[model samples]
Target: MEAVALHISNGVLNGPVSAIYGVIALVALAYCVSRGRRDLDDRLAPMAGLVAAFIFAVQMLNFPVLPGVSGHLLGGAMAALLVGPWVGALCVSVVLIVQALVFADGGVTALGANVANMALLGTAVAYLLIALLLRVLPRTPTGLGITAFVSSVFAVLAASQGFVLQYALGGTTDLEHYSLGAIAGLMAGTHLLIGIGEGLIAAVTVVTVARTRPDLVYALRGLKRPQPATAQGVAA
Candidate 1:
């Protein structure tokens, strides 16, 4: 018989670890709520809904990896790039909430850790890394694509590390059998492929939006849109 898939379950974490993650998730989500209320506008409202839905749908189709492991798009980096970090976090959080409560995809007790890792850590890493990269790279579509790709790769890895940290703190698994080093290596290694897929999808989406509707892509907000090849040096 095949081993059951983990699906972001936190069965390994104990009570104290879960509680700590819960508190952190609550505080972070509260902050996001505060920021979103102030920064979110009518322009972003529709996009936010669409992005959240897209992430929810994308997460449903998990592709098989080595043996029992499977991988899926976190969509955190893409969301953060399209929307602001606060709203992006909210988007992923919403997806996680529905998955946990309605579908029972992840553990009810582990919801906090799931949100903290995928929603908070993933989104924050994407925003910070891409922002830093934008400083060195040009303000063109290619630059933004590159920024999104690199940031997304790191974002997934960071989220995996979050899980490893939780496991180290209060994992239910025997240390000898599922050692911290081994767990971290496995999580990070599997997510590396997932991250590459995430980066590619994020880059393509950003490039598409930048080409057609640059206004929708929050990361490219301040930067000037690229002109068509036929309209070189032409005023519109």
Candidate 2:
């Protein structure tokens, strides 16, 4: 059997559910746009574009998990750590939109669920966790990397559950062979491994940027301590 595609396809969800989610996604994105403006400036605007591009590219590559299952990078935690949550959500949403429209990676009808899962819910959960972890974790590059790794794992998990919820609400499939519990279990198990891979990528990416341009990292702002003037001068 082939692995399930990372993107949701049309008809997996009922029409009413898909339409409802579409409206929800539109409202959420409108809110993101309002809030994202505050985070966008000369430096962050370019970084947001780059983050979106990187996410779009990486999401194309899927690695095997189980025999019939595969997973790809979600980029929620990575984006949230690099850019503010509002902008991060927008970045991921843009990637999903392009993938669905241009690449046909996800069904156009299922675009709402996809956006709600990977973009809004995943990014929000990751950013919140990152914020909480940063409060206690060391204010250093290593700490931020660790935080990203841990948060990415949960972000994927959370996004998986979002699918489960939608399916429960209005799944078009028969429930005789596959129970909701079974579906949830499979999604959670497969996505847990995928999350680990995502976490590693997020950790490495965040650490690299934090070391070089800490200023560009939204999560590091006000959290990362200023390096000693002499140390900065020497590094420069």
Candidate 3:
């Protein structure tokens, strides 16, 4: 905890007044869209809640580098891969907001920036990458694994670059020790390695869904798994 605080003190990631407000506005938009269709089976609600809580738990484990410079799995891609993007974003954002308001892990002032980095950037980038890879890779479990792996890796790196950009646009710290270029490259590179872990988790989860409950692996279905009644009526 103190170590994280020290890292924050040493880190040069700050947003400008205008960008901060813009981030807040975007978060509000996302929050509004996050109602997530209550008509859907309520059982999924518990699944989503559990997934969010598990991600939060993993995030707290922060693997360290020299006791400070470390990366943690924020579960942006994992959530999106498990559920859909809208639900995934809402899950991560909820977790982040709670951390800020209740735990004081991220804080309210910079809450938007944190969301932009972890939830928005991470999920958006990962989704795009996976979509592209799916187009090229064979529609098989191996292909799913490969695509999930690469996308997860780059998404983390892109989030790091996003931070560098955000800070460069409105940074409050002296970036001499960690120049924008160096920071971007180092963080991205480290995240690329971390993505390996993300990739494996995503791949395993997808394959599990594919084998067990095909309805849950929406991405692979090529269509929304319509409710059972719809499928039964169509069959009849």
- TM-score for candidate 1, please give it: 0.88
Q: List candidate 2 segments past 4 Å from native.
A: 1-4, 222-236
Instruction: Compose the digit string of candidate 1's lDDT tens values, residues 72-106.
Output: 88888888888878899999999999888887778
lDDT of 3 by residue, 1-236 (tens): 35243112212444464356446638654563554553135655676787689777877766644344566776777776666566666678788878877776765666666677777778888778767776776555566667667777777777777767777777776756877788788877777766666667667766665556655554555333343443321122
Best by TM-score: 2
RMSD for each of the candidates: 3.4, 2.8, 5.3
- Where does candidate 3 stray beyond 4 Å? 5-15, 18-43, 64-69, 222-236
- Model 1 regions more than 4 Å off: 1-6, 64-68, 222-236
Q: lDDT values of the candidates?
A: 0.82, 0.89, 0.64
The TM-score measured for candidate 2 stands at 0.92
Best by lDDT: 2
Model 2: per-residue lDDT, tens digit, 1-236? 54335689999999999999999999999999999998899989999999999998888778887796778999999999999899999999999999888877789999999999999999989988998998887757878889999999999999999999999999998789888999999899999999998999899988888888887889867346565454431133
Cα-based RMSD of candidate 3: 5.3
